[model samples]
Target: MPTPDFVLALREHVGHDLLWMPGVTAFVLDADRQHMLAVRRADTGAWTPVTGIIDPGEEPASAAVREVAEEAGVDCAPLRLVDVRTHPPLTFPNGDHAQFLDLCFVCEHTGGEPYPADGENTEARWFPLEDPPPMNDRFLAQLQIVLADRPEARFRR
Candidate 1:
């Protein structure tokens, strides 16, 4: 579902209030690690990694994998947690506000061609890792961290 049932239920009590949520960004790399999956968001038309809110009681890594499949029409396995950071708070056009604790994961593409499977995105495809399409500063920063392949996940201080 686009909006989770839990979030809808909570909205009944807190209309338009900022809701702190846990989210996932899945950087899905092909088996050979030469390319990464990206999706053009339907709302913003910006290219980004597969992103979604983690369901209540769901593991972040599992959410990453699930998001890749949901948004990009591909199966993947989380290779590692790459970053943990708080996203800037924003209000939706509908007046709902939310801030996210983002868990970014590097996932290995297990199978299937990439396409925008969900209405949330318009286009989904693989891009060369060395030269991905342009992204906003926030996403580019996370991309750089993933490319560095550090031993530990980056935690914003």
Candidate 2:
């Protein structure tokens, strides 16, 4: 995972202190609706939809598109906004702390096969949505919200 330069600079100032971050997650589904592309994170070996931090000056939707390409080697078009959510604070193994405001999106697969294009993922592949590897509540919720195809975006106050 490439840490944005700004985040690296911020860490220089605050070390492991908590920082609020903006991020994006992509639920990349297949045309058949049976499988979705996801990554098994290299760090924790946990499965997650394509996700990455939003760079400074970058649009959230753009970040979601970029994450899908960079993490899964797939091209996609944002079909709809899924949700805007604030996740609980987290601390990495190295003790860096952060809270995230995540923008989730559903992307229609445009082209390319799925693979782990970046080092952050051990593997990237399409998984059956009905039996996705156990994931956090937020991820499952986003999956449900996106799958529903509701006209309105899911929001967290």
Task: Output the number of the lDDT-best candidate.
Answer: 1
Off by over 4 Å in 2: none
lDDT of 2 by residue, 6-120 (tens): 9999999999999999999999888887888889999889899998899989988889999899988999988878899888999888899999988888887889998999899
**How many residue pairs of model 1 clash at the backbone?**
0
Query: Which pairs clash inside model 2?
Result: none
**lDDT agreement with native, every candidate:** 0.91, 0.88
Poorest 10 consecutive residues by lDDT, candidate 1? 1-10
Best by TM-score: 1
- The ten-residue window of minimal lDDT in model 2 covers 132-141
RMSD to truth, every model: 1.1, 1.5
TM-score, candidate 1, is 0.96
